[model samples]
Target chain A: MAGYAVELRAVWKRFLGPAGETVAAVKELSLQIADGEFFALLGPSGCGKTTTLRMVAGFELPSDGEVLIQGKPMGKTPPYQRPVNTVFQNYALFPHMTIGENVAFGLQMQKVGRQEVQRRVGDALEMVRLSGLERRRPKQLSGGQQQRVALARALVNRPQVLLLDEPLGALDLKLRKEMQLELKKLQREVGITFVFVTHDQEEALTMSDRIAVMDAGVALQVGSATQIYEQPNCRFVADFIGETNFLEGSVQQLQGGQALVELPGGLSVWASMAQPVAVGNPVTVAVRPEKLTLRPLEAPLANQLQGQVVDQVYIGTDTYYSVRLASGQTIRVREQNNLAALRQGAQPGDTVCVQFVAETASVLTG
Target chain B: MSQPRQSPWLAALSGLVYFFLYAPIVVLIVFSFNVSRTNVVFEGVVNQGPCGPFYWYCELLQNRSVADAARNTLIIAVTSTAVSTLIGTLAALALQRYEFFGKKSAETALYFPMVTPEIVMGIGILVLFSALFGWVNSMLPPGLRLTLGLGTVIVSHIAFSIPFVTLVVRARLHGFDSRLEEAAMDLGAPPLTTFLRITLPLIAPGVLAGAMLAFTLSLDDFIITFFTTGPGATTLPIYVYGLLRRVVTPEVNALSTLWILVVLTVVGLSQWFQQRE
Candidate 1:
């Protein structure tokens, strides 16, 4: 069996800018995708996710390192020789060819027999649910159908690995949501290793088996969706993935996988530790908005702080409360709309308790 | 055209412009049917001459020099258009697709033939060919010496026509998306296969337009041909210039009418190609 479907070892890409300035587009990135795994490279624009995908597809050569497919290093291999295919962001289908011919292009390039190519193209179109569109050109299809044609065009090759660069980015919101689930099901049915690139965090969370979150040409963390969201390794990953409140403090003591921190407001709190921490070292406690609970200030609560509701917004499914602590820091709290008036009708200028346990918060030192 | 905002004044102005522009050609075509030989004025048409309704056309077919001149014009136009279109398309592809040293300079240099005055170009080519022939004759014996001929005129036509062809092709390329080539490569087509199956077919209309432009340019060229042509290589335009100095006949009107017809058909075909695209 082929080992990993795709691998990158210490890859780096440096581009010379218009003014002769060198900028590192991707830096020291090494990753491995298991066979049949749906791996995603997620980041903001200019974060090098697209560049990494291009390097894997052989559109751009790494300035320093190797890319491997099926456990074999591909050195100086042209894109047409590699055992992989790419679905470009623009869906670059040939305008001169019909949908059937577009899907059959790869097979024809490989010199497959005529009968086999015809049968395989018909089956591939059927797999994408575009059975009767064999005679229609790309311009005649709708945006969503054209997207399916791009998918079928790449999947017809049955390459060892498939690379997708924001394949659904051009669609409207409703169509993009539908395509997200369709792509996941399609990947499983084909059982091909899919390496997707996207900037949408929710898409990566919904579709990827594992994700590498990148920023500024470097991958800050790589993990499952739950691990990245609940136990991020750094503040950037925590803030980038979701809304998190940072409470600055210094470590007073270290317990079993937990740190006791003293806040600037003279409050001592406990937060889960994911990395090494020394006593008296400065650290930031990151807690998601939904993780923190808000209650009336006079309630009998342990480990709670007095805060005033600064603002309140009801967004149909949930209500967001902006609360300001006595120590001059504002934090957001989210509560489900199950409650009648959102946190029991907590309005601006009302006093409340911002309460959280150690398990809901993580300590970040760097 | 869909806006429906036409004003009669603007329409009348354009109509007047068209009348002025086409009146001379219309007069020429009408005179080709005139039976009078001198063609100073329209005497009559149809059943007046023994040669039939197309009297001047029959005279033109019988004239030997007209046939030779027509043949020479076709040979020069076809050969020069094919060569210029090929080389110019290659130059356009190279300029548009690659990053190289002096690329800016090369792109700017293609406009030299386009912006330079055609009369200046004609004189320069004459002096250059004369110098070249002088050097070749000085080295060789008298029987084998090179001189200006059909080959020299053809070379000059190709030189002037390339810039127009390249500019036309380059304008078409400005709107092309390069990612299609990458997608072809990703689909396992090699570079040559991708170019043959994808690039050439997509850019075909632009190449045809450039070829038509080159052909029309080569057909009517007179100044360059006048200086560079040798014995027995006179094209229709140069031959007509010689006839102008000697006599003004209705056959010249017939030739001009035929010239206008060929240009109109070529232009019609080019428009058809663009609309099909």
Candidate 2:
């Protein structure tokens, strides 16, 4: 816990194609993670998340920078010399060996004493809840079971860093969710630095302590889940993280730190921050569907607009309404269902007023 | 639409094709016991001119020279097949695993010997050994002649069998998952240990199949061995050729039947092992 578990400094990797053409897989990326932290690289496909993980695992070497483990630079260090292990996407379990043998493979390679290897392998399997499956080959297990065996194999080595490259991508939804919690528990018990890579936003949000969301080989933001969801820095993260309602308008007037936005047809709305926009600068206002509150047509409130409900959908625990404003812009509003109280329902042609607080919305520049 | 009754035309055509392939072997086996020496005859049923217990067959078996030749042939076939499979499988793994310059050229070179004419290869080897060492006849025993002996025959069989083994092993390697080896390496195993413990076991069935093929090919080989063997190193095929020319004896037919039996046994075992995997 005293030293950084892993450090990657200005790493750049380029792959040469068959015809002498170079394709940059990763640009200069520098990052550090303390001991026992669960850091995740979240991004879409071809965004260099997997490439970055491979470089740390020593499967691929960076063309321009140095990688370090425990305060020592890794120059041409083979995978066996590095104190790190990787769980590949497809599990990569040895089909010819039994589960116990696969787990003991690393210990046997180090020529550890026989009894010690067996005890550690058993403990690793038990941690993953795969006890008593020692003699079964990988082909006999289900996809999820195979993935657990792979995890056990990598963990048996007691490496300083565990690199997971989309380990749960091959599993179905239910199994993936179950393993997500299991992995979190295992990480806590082992207390090692875990660097995981995935393209699923929800998965990252649920398990990671810190996330680095990347796009096209560049990391756009790194923060806690709440920060990433509530205050995305750009249009990509805002659209990728969750659902948002966007309103295009220009800043009609700015005072102090707040600005009044004028929508088309002279409808004015107050925005909380004018840091990203000046007077007469165009911007898009983003508000969550749950943030907008609906009321009767006669209610009077600041930032109030009258609109007709065009459609309504009743989910199990909530009701959603599509409201059309006077200028023909449709806005979505969600209301929680209260089973104990009875109220009048909004119809397709009913006029309604919707209001959003000034602090509940933010403006997007691009 | 209702399916038509079994097509008589299709059945007849396929039956004719089967007959076209097997008719010669059937004719040869049937005439092996013929009594008349006119080289062709229908002996019909019993009392066929006092057949004398097919004495030509017993005489052939009693000859010590024939027994020695059969022993030599079996030794060469088994040994060469084993060695060639080892080399071929290693070559196949190298070709399939790594990316390097001249890979395509290396693959083509491995297959080149398989397609070359046997006579040309035999003559080339004979010339090279004689010109390089000058020991073809001047310094060798009679049984160790370059054109006829156990050593030359084994060498020739191994040369031709390697390409077939490589081709079969390469096909199996194509479907293999190399990540299994990577996993082993990550687990702290060295490169060679990973290959032996994980990769080889997964592809053992393919190696067995390739060895069977090499054995069968070596057992039946004639042209190459005829050019490279010594007098004492003559194999079953060369011996049968001599009998077929000198006397046109029924003993040759009996020998041919034995060869067919050995070939079929190897083929059956190969198929069984392949299906088991």
Give Cα-based local distance difference scores for all models: 0.91, 0.82
- Candidate 1 residue-wise lDDT, B67-122, digit = tens: 99999999999999999999999999999999999999998898887888888999
Q: Please write out the lDDT profile of model 1 over residues A53-117, one tens digit for every residue.
A: 98888899999989999999988899999999999898999999999999999999999999999
Q: Provide the TM-score for each candidate, comma-separated.
A: 0.96, 0.86
Residue A296, candidate 1: how far off, in angstroms? 1.8
Candidate 1 CAPRI category: high
The alpha-carbon deviation from the true structure for residue B24 of candidate 2, after best TM-score superposition, in angstroms, is 5.5
Q: What is the lDDT of residue A302 in candidate 2?
A: 64
- Please provide, for model 2 over B25-133, each residue's C-alpha lDDT reduced to its tens digit, 9 standing for 90 to 100: 7766655556544346746422232345454456557888779878988999999999999998988888988888999998899898888888898888777655754
DockQ of 1: 0.88
Residue B276 in model 2: shift from native, Å?
3.8
